[model samples]
Target: MPSVLKTQPWNVHRLPAAEGKRFLVTGGNAGIGYFVAEQLAGTGATVVLGSRDAAKAEAAIASIRSRVPGAKVQHLRLDLADLASLKTSVDALGPDRLDAVVYNAGVALDHPPRRETKDGHELMFATNHLGHFALTGWLAPLLVATPGSRIITTGSFAAKSERLDFDDLQNTHDYRPKRTYGRSKLAQMLFSFELDRRLRAAGSTTLSVVVHPGGALDSLTPSRPQVRVRTTGERLRGLPLGLLVQGKEAGAWPAVRAVLDPDVRGGHLWGPRVFGLRGRPGLAPIWDHLADTTTAARLWAASCDLTGVAPTFTPV
Candidate 1:
């Protein structure tokens, strides 16, 4: 059966066929990323789970295959926290052309005295923004070569209120875990818009779209056994919150839509419909800070310097 037509409501369960295409979902081992990978797999596309843990990746792949029988899925060892390893990760993606890449992996630090990676960069910022920035630069060539390719970034509602302190991008002088995490995500959203502008100027066919999961909770998500086991108590507790929050599966909607929707274009922000919180994915208004090109340009330059990956997009 063909996936539902493009109309009033976007249906997550009925995605259009994407045969022969390849998509990468970072942190696909669990949470929203897992559901994104699984749903894309059902479209007859090759879904590669970008994860740091081999065991977790295997479990996710198994779970996907079980759900999407004959699903084309595999694992790619990706440690986004390690910027130096991203280029190698891209090279290992093989000769198959990439159709899309969903930047969904993220690290959330609820409380902390602040942490840094081996590369001496803040952990959440490194994993959430810089790593993807570097990875995108590495993958730029492949994306440029593939017709109608897309780069989907997963931002967060938590980032809407945050703004970057260009002088203190890493929150070096003063750091609060949650706020810093939000800032990192804001960076991701800013990058997404800036990348779209660059791609357009270069006349590249690759589209860059940003999305937010919008209040997804594990307790509200469905169980995938090997991937995750939601307790009965958890489900009961989550039932009441469904009006305001959604499951990780539902949270995966916007990114998945951005990847496959023919109507979706670059510089667009997609999220849940109801209060931008819980419901089917739809076009969400871009936060004001996301449109500050000056900040985005500065962030891009800093990212290039930090990762040493300068992306030059030109028609391929």
Candidate 2:
């Protein structure tokens, strides 16, 4: 191997077939999650898709199979918006070993009239951060048991300017949809990095990585009738998509690299190389504000308290 390879991440061109490995993805029914599952399946890995919609999950599986003949794919119904549903989904997964997990499901856009989930959490907060928090806790044992396993959590550029609103985590008082969404993504990054730190402190082998699929727009994403159904507005938006935003297929590269890149270490955060919004995946910079141990610990404690899911690691 070259000397540089030992110090830097590798660019993925031809992913070595991951035969006998097992991977799971959240929101695998559509968009970037569907693409993530598809690419992993293409590499000979058995994939379990966690989705809320059965029909959509089935369609995604069918779509994967069409491209990769005899792809080993299964669906586990997981509702990221519901804590009970998340618990049920984890129970269905059993205590089996998994090679990796991609926390790909998230609410990327702002919703009108902010609402709370059945768990009484802000809708975006619940689905984007809370659900993943609980799910990871439920599956931590299996993850730690499997040597070299990795966890990749998706984040966003909007998080670059976000600071967690601990006082109003649910945005109950000043409920701005876009700001709430940004905080949620920031929370994911905080959780993932803290998880990595804890894993290392406990001398665990499993790694936690954070990545963002920069600007994955609906107009640029592939049209799959069974999975993604773009409307008239979305079609119209496609006219200018090529000029700015890259396709979702390209967008998924950062995440895929985060999971399978041999050079990635625990706590590593990766994103696009150019403008932090487009081009090939690379190790990008993150705001130093996110590195505050005090804030991270506070968020970690609050997450456990709210979701009732405790991590399996101890502090160093």
Candidate 3:
């Protein structure tokens, strides 16, 4: 594995995103999301911070305004755990189109047993994949309407642990929190790749990209109330192993690179250079199986059926 510090650093400061573009970033309150939102705001783009918590989103916006001095930042309530919230947010987002939508919100369930969201999907699957899946589907028109629009989904290196379990998509039969989380992240990457393929096939110009922050101990993985006990146990295990994790800022870089770098190609993966785990941002190779046409087509159909929202705009 390349060390996290050895990779080439991404100079996001050189990005010219301030030229009257609009962006929507989920979980923009703190950690990597905060940094991504802050940097974009600094560039003078109209940034919409998406959060389940209204207060946190507002505070995040305030913090960005303070840093950027006239940074155009706003907040919208979006609870990835609830399909109703997703619908409301999409409806309430109004007709204003977006230049990009960054799916940065995620959760890590370290709790015992397992839980499901209001949508009857596993919590990890619901929040990390389905919610974002539905949101992006709903906003496809807005994204497609804007020229050069991009959709960036936050994935994780942990995804390497497992492949999608189609038989048990919700983990109701066999539930392991970590494995479930990995499956969700893997689904996210697959979704991005599949979406890109669909868009291209339809002749759409929009871009869909996926990125993973090496190993930043950021809020991307929040301890749910039910999972706190497991987290404590894991922390104890880590103490003896002496694992060195990078900060959230380092994790935020890959996603930032995916969003701001004009050279970033659709379906490319980005991560830190060292062992591809930590350091500066660079394009990383994706697993070949992820690009399988059959898999991508099937998943897209499954998403549409599950979400009950067919994509309105075909890529062209």
Candidate 4:
């Protein structure tokens, strides 16, 4: 099992402005991604909001500009559901080296039947995992340009409930939206760990870290009858089982910690300290089986094959 470390919970008051850093935050228009961009920008980091909607991206930039008068914020068009859009956004990033890329964008299927994204992949799986997978792969060159560049991805506690179904990646055999979403997140967690291993083995300095917001109520949560019932019951009973089920700002802390903490080691998972629910930021534990070498390798191969982007690192 990966060792869990206890550390002080991080708060925004002590966060330093990223004066010299450049960051790209996916889904920065609203929810957790917005707060993360705001915090990073407050620290003087040049933040680029990556959104599927150009207008929404521009509006998000304006909102940030209002708060942080001199905030350096820009918008880059990116649609996770469209591979062509992903490629265009990456190519349009110009030649600037990126300090960090936070994969905060995700979706949950509210209905029972499975839906497909523009890329012909399961909606939840494509938006939550593969989309980010392709984006990160395309942006690897820019990430490599900077020393200590980090790729921070958002996972979820739900990942514990669903394991990757390698045979049914797209849910062709059995399409359960909830299960699919969980599987996608599991893939994300595994990818983060595997990427770190591969980077180190290839002698690369870039870091890949995964984090879960716990069970925060954000836009990603489904409002379907079943979802509402389950969530409502948890709230009514005051169940503390959900990981970090709190406000958007609190939920974004793990990603923020992963992005800014100079001492954070590669491959570490961070989240809320209180019952895996809402709280100040702390080092969150990862299940040992989540780091299985065999599983990681298989997922890595599958992601590459599915996305058509070869791993940049030559495995040793």
Candidate 5:
């Protein structure tokens, strides 16, 4: 690790200007994704909220405009679960070059009988991993055409201890909601690293970086009435938890930094500085499981087979 990466002071409030650049954030209507979009919009870049619901996206856009005053933001109908609609959704992304796409959207089932998407895949796996896998493939042309474009994957700390069961990738046999969700996220992170390797091998300038929000809590998040309304009591109760966890806004820092920081490189994992839980965004060490190239390659093949989309990179 470079000493600069360790010592550089990154002021989350003072973001670099990104005028004329365009970014797409999946599930940008809520949680950390919403904050990611809001922060990027503050950079004077056009921000598109890729979501499945129009009403939620509109509310998020309105909230951003209210805060940033003239923030260029819009909604793009994107349903990650619906792999069939991904190509059409990319088409709707317009003909303009995309500077970055943040894979932040995810579905975590709290209590489940193990749901499946219309595509006949596990719901969590479909939405969190396969969806972005396919979307990246569809967006390859636009991304490859744009100089120095980025694909940022928002992984999870929950995935730290989990490992992908290649035999039961979809959790068809035994599905524990939380464990399965962690595996799905682990799969996504591995894909990002594998994608970076592929991009480098293809001699592409497009970078694929992975980041994870330490621990984000709605109670700790600031109130954005149009999107999220955190009650006074909730804030008071969450104050104690702030010692270890953080608000969604702070949680957005890693991904935001991954997008705007010129120093960020492909195949690196960035996260919170304090115990990988809360604090300023910084370069975090990649987990041992994440470095297993064999596992990543297997996941890539499985993803391509499942989503029917294989991304190919070329130098810009």
Candidate 6:
């Protein structure tokens, strides 16, 4: 039987089929990242799954191949917490053009205390925001070459209560893990929106968009032996939470919309339709922080200074 939901607005299948297109998805080894790759690759896009783990990345490739028979998928060695790894991935994409890049990889929910990246920054800030800021800057040349190519930064509901802390970019003092994570996500939204503004000012054709997956849980994500193996506790909590929360497959829709929807304008946020949590994808209402251009510019300036990469986008 044909799926019933396709007729409804926000159906994942409604997105046009993609062929001869290439996409890069960071953190594609697991969770919503993996599902985003799967959905895009299933439509015949060459999906590069980027993660720090070679073995797990290969496993994700295998999973995509299995589920989407003839899926064009590949592995990209990427460590969100490291810059050398970004260099490696950039070299891999040398001269190869991409249709879009989804900055979906991030550290979330669990970690050691006061931990930092090899670059000597807070792990959450370094991994979630800094790494993507660097990656986007590095890829600006390639992104500009492709017509209508987009850079999609994943935002979070956590950003609602967060504010920029310029005095402490690393979040070293009074650092609560959850709040720190939230602030990093806030940084992402700020960066994407600011990027679109700069692209416009510079007359660049590369688009920048932000989408947030509300409360997507890895526990509800299915187990893939080499990629993501759910724990017994995750299985227990996942099944119950699955009732109220979305699995990774459902969680990926908003991002897919941002990538494939020609009508979607840059700088507008997209989220799940119902309460920004669990439901079909829809246009997200703007929050006060989202509209604050001053704050967005501040965060963008800080990112460039900290990452030490200046992106020069020549107008198309």
Model 2 — TM-score against the truth?
Answer: 0.92
How far in Å is the alpha carbon of 312 misplaced in model 2? 1.0
RMSD to true structure for each model, in Å? 3.3, 3.1, 5.5, 5.1, 1.2, 4.3
| CA lDDT, every model vs. true structure | 0.92, 0.83, 0.77, 0.80, 0.94, 0.82
Ranking by lDDT: 5, 1, 2, 6, 4, 3
Off by over 4 Å in 3: 1-10, 218-245
Q: After superposition, how far is residue 193 of candidate 2 from its true place, in Å?
A: 0.7
Question: Which stretches of model 1 miss by more than 4 angstroms?
Answer: 1-9
What TM-score fits each model?
0.97, 0.92, 0.86, 0.88, 0.98, 0.91
Model 1: per-residue Cα lDDT over 1-316, one tens digit each? 0122243566888999999999999999989999999999999999999999999999999999999989999999999999889889999998779999999999998887889999999999999999999999989989988999999999987787898998899999878998999999999999999999999999999999999988999999999999899999999999999989899999999999999988888898888989999899888777778889999999999999998888878776
lDDT comparing candidate 5 with the true structure: 0.94
Q: Per-residue lDDT for 1-316 in model 3, tens only?
A: 2112243335755656556888899998776887788778877788898998887787777777766888999888889888766777878778886988899998888976788776777888888988888898789888888878899999887888677767777788878889889988888889898888778877888889888887776332333232112265565554532244555656777777777777777787888867776677787877766767676667777877777766655743
- Cα lDDT tens digits for candidate 4, 1-316: 3345544456656896678789999998777788788778888989999998887777778777877889999989888988767888999889887999999988887677778876688888888888888887788888888888999989888888777777777788767778878888898889889889888988888899988887676433322231122365545544443333676667888899889988677888888878777777778777877869899899888888888876584321
> Which one is best on TM-score?
5
Q: In angstroms, what RMSD does candidate 4 have relative to the true structure?
A: 5.1
- In model 3, which residue pairs have backbone atoms overlapping below 3 Å? 1-275, 2-274, 2-275, 3-274, 4-278, 4-279, 111-227, 203-316, 204-315, 204-316
Q: Indicate whether candidate 2 or candidate 3 has the larger TM-score.
A: 2
Residue 195 error, candidate 4, Å: 0.5
Pairs that collide in candidate 5 are none
Task: Kindly give the stretch of ten consecutive residues in candidate 4 with the minimal lDDT sum.
Answer: 220-229
lDDT string, candidate 5, 169-257, tens digits: 99999789999999999999999999999999999999999999999999999999999899999999999999999999999999999
Best prediction by lDDT: 5
Query: Which runs of model 6 end up more than 4 angstroms from their true locations?
Result: 1-9, 109-112, 229-243
Better of 1 and 6 by lDDT: 1
Q: List the residue pairs that clash in candidate 4.
A: 17-43, 18-43, 214-243, 215-243, 215-245, 243-276, 244-276, 244-277, 244-278
